[model samples]
Structure formats: structure tokens, C-alpha cells
Target: MVLTNVEEQMSLRLAVEDFLFEESALLDDGRFREWLDLVTEDVRYVIPVQTTRERAHGSAGSTTMAHWDDDYIGLEMRILRLDTEYAWAEDPPSRLRHFVSNVRVRPGSEPDEYEVRSNVMVSRGRGDSRATDLLTAERQDVLRRTDQGFRLARRTVVLDHVVIATHNLAFFF
Candidate 1:
């Protein structure tokens, strides 16, 4: 049976939400290798540094300055580092919880691609620490349809705070 336009849109939204939720779960579970599989070979994952600017200025984030600018290879390398003893940041491993909300999905320039926007809040608690750090951001993503499912092609995370208060940014968003 053929679905109506509204039904199709609803179905697509649910699929996108499911994909994002799964990704979050993987990160929360420290399953970096499995998360990597959800991304495309040419994936570009970036987190631009947010700046406090006047209303006259166009964007708050700098195109050049980024907390993270990674391709598939870079991401793979980072994940590999986590496995080694040299990864001091994650020696004890941080407990992470990702809260994703306000997901919006739309068609992309490519037929098999979709543009998705969402808000994310990550809570991190390190070993023997009572303090839990909270990081909030807006994420813009390009998901490409593949035989397996939707794969992340591109992602840009814009942080809410201009000055980050977290101890370290060793976790993913």
C-alpha cells in the first residue's frame, strides 16, 4: 500500500530518531568501534568553537577554529588511541549519558541524503568524582541512505556555551 506524504514524513522522522538514539546509546556504552560503523567512509565530524559576538556579526562560530575536525581516518585513529594505555584522559573511563531532543529532518541536496538537526545534552561523571559535567549543543547532520541503513556523512556540533566549563572534552557528543 502507498503511504500519504504526511505518513511518509512521519515514518522518515521516526527512522531518523531511532538512528540518532542508537548512536547515542553506542557512545554512552563506550562502543566507539560500533559507532564508527554508523558513519560513512567520507564522514566529516566537527565541533566548532563558539564565540560571543555582537548582533551585527554573522555567525558565532569560526569556520577555521574547531574543537574537533575529523574525517574517517582521524576518527579511527582517535578510537584506536582509546584502546592504548597512552590515552590518559580515559584511563578510568567517564560515565556518559547523551540526551537527544528536538529532532528535525528534511531532504538534502542529494536524493539519498537527509539533513537532520537536533539538540543534545551530555552528562559526564568521571571516576571517584561527585561532580557531573553537563554539555549542551546543537547538532546538524547529513545522513546518507545505504544498504545497511542511514550512515552519518557529515556532522557539525555548535556548543551552547562560549566558555566551556568541562574538565576535559574527551567524550563524543
Candidate 2:
């Protein structure tokens, strides 16, 4: 017999939760390359800028979207750049720990896709700078149960913190 809506949602939620745990584990362990491999080649991974004026209107503006946003090639280039002799972001590198919880899955219009919402707490120590960045957001993902496995077709991370505490936009959430 086939699965019902609740069952399907449960399964998808577990898949995504697994993905999140693995991804966070990789990041925490400093296995960036392994984490990078999880993302789709043509992934639409972006965190748009939010404004205060958008309070009455909304949160984001399309114009503030990253000028040189990443595709697979761009992500790869970033990896290569960081793997070089002179990478400012990672001369010594920072220690990071990501805490994720309260994962909620909302089934989407498409059968293979769902809306995932989660709370995040990212702690990092770079040189003398110590900070525990907190970003509560909902991740809208279009997941596909592909031949390879469940892969994200699209993911938009809508962060609750309009003014970010994180120093760089280098990590994938």
C-alpha cells in the first residue's frame, strides 16, 4: 500500500532532518568539501537582504539580492579560492557549531516537494572574536526523491534576523 499524507510528510521530514544533521555535522567537523557535495549542481542557494522599511510591506527586496550569487561553479570557485595560499576568510579558520531544532515540514503544492521550517543557532569563534549568532528562519525547499536520493531542487532561507550577527555569508544553512 501507498503512504498517506501524514506518513509521506513524516518520511520527508525525516529525510530533511537527516540531511540537516549530516550537513551540520560536516560543517562542525570542518569537512566543507563533503558538505559542498550535498548541494545540487544548479542549486539556487541565496540569502536575500532584509530591510527595516519592509516591516509594513515585507522582509526582502529583489534588488538587494547578491550581485554575484552562486551557482555550482561559483560555489566550487569559492572552495578553490579558500583552498589557496592566500584566503583571508580562512587563514587560521574559525571553530563553528550549529544547533538546529524545531523542524516543521509543510507539504507543498508539488508532491515531491515540501516547505521546511527550522530554528537555528550558530556559534563561532574566529581569532579573538567570539559570537553566538542566532538566526531563526524557515527554509523553503523543493525536494526531489531522485535516483541518487533526496536532493533539493530549490532552497530559500528566510532569516528572522534582518541585521545579521555573522561576519560572513560563507556558510550554507
Candidate 3:
């Protein structure tokens, strides 16, 4: 049966939501390598520095200082480092959970691309540590539709907090 434009768009949106959910699951499961495959070769993942100021100042973030700004190669290096025994940050490995919600998807300039925005909350706890850190943010992502499915082309994370409350960020957001 032929689908109308609206129906098709809705289907695409739903598909993107499923893709995002799967990605979240992978992260929570500590499947870093597998999660990397869901991104494009030229993927840009960045988290800009958030600041607090008067309303007249405009936006709350500045790209000049990024918490994380990485391309495919950089991301790969980070993933590789996680495997090293000396990677103290993740030596014991922190238990993490990624909660993604409020997903919104729309068409992009490219026919096979989409612009997606979502809210994210990451909770983490290290070995023998009673304290848990919660980091919350809003992510703007560009997803490209490929033969296999949707792959992340770019991601910009804008944290809600002006000052990061987490002890260390050793895992991907």
C-alpha cells in the first residue's frame, strides 16, 4: 500500500525514535565499540561549556570551551583508551544508565538526513561508591539515513547545569 507524505514522515520519526532508544541501551550496557558503529565516519560529537548570565546575554553556552569536541578518529581513540589497563577513570568501570526522552525529529536539508533533539539524563556510580552522579542535558543531533539505517552524523550537547556536578566524565554521552 502506498503511504501519504504525512504518514511516511511519521514513520520516519518513529524509526528515528527507535534508533535513539537502541543507542541509549547500548550506552547503558557499556557497549562502547558497538555504539560507535552507529555513527558516521565523519561524525562530530561535541559538548559545549554552559554558563549563567543575564537574559540579555542570549544563549547560555559557548562553543569556545567544550567539555568534549570529537570527530570519528578522536572518538575511536577514546574508545581504545577505555580498553587499556591503565585507564584508571574506567579501570573498575562505572555503572551507568542513559535516560533519553522528549525526542523530536524533523527533516533536514538533505533528503536522507534528519534533525533530532532530545533530553538526556546520565546517572553513574563507581565501584564501592555510594554516591551517584546525575548529568542532564539537551542534545541536538543530525542523523543520516543509510542503507543499514540511521547513523549519527553530528551531536551537540548543551548541559542544563552551569557547573558540572559529576566527579569525572569517563563515558560517552
Best by TM-score: 1
Q: In model 2, which runs have C-alpha deviations exceeding 4 angstroms? A: 1-5, 60-63, 108-111, 130-136
Q: How much is the lDDT of residue 117 in candidate 1?
A: 100
Q: Candidate 2, which ten residues in sequence have the lowest lDDT sum?
A: 59-68
User: Positional deviation of 162 in candidate 3, in angstroms?
Assistant: 1.4
* Candidate 3 per-residue C-alpha lDDT over 85-141 given as tens digits, one digit per residue, 9 for 90 to 100: 878988788899889999888778788888899999999998898999999999999
Which candidate ranks first by lDDT, i.e. highest?
1
Clashing pairs in 3: none
Looking at model 2, residue 24 earns an lDDT score of: 84
Work out the TM-score per prediction: 0.97, 0.80, 0.94
Which 10 successive residues of model 1 have the least lDDT summed?
1-10
Q: Which stretches of candidate 3 lie over 4 Å from their true place?
A: 1-4
Candidate 2 C-alpha lDDT tens digits along 1-173: 23477877687778889987887898887787886777777677665665556467764635566523567777778777777886777667767788888988766666765656677777676777554555556666665556666666666676766677767766566
Q: Count the backbone clashes (under 3 Å) in each candidate.
A: 0, 0, 0
Point out where model 1 deviates above 4 Å: 1-4
Q: RMSD to the native, candidate 3?
A: 2.4
Positional deviation of residue 49's Cα in model 1 after best superposition, in angstroms: 0.8
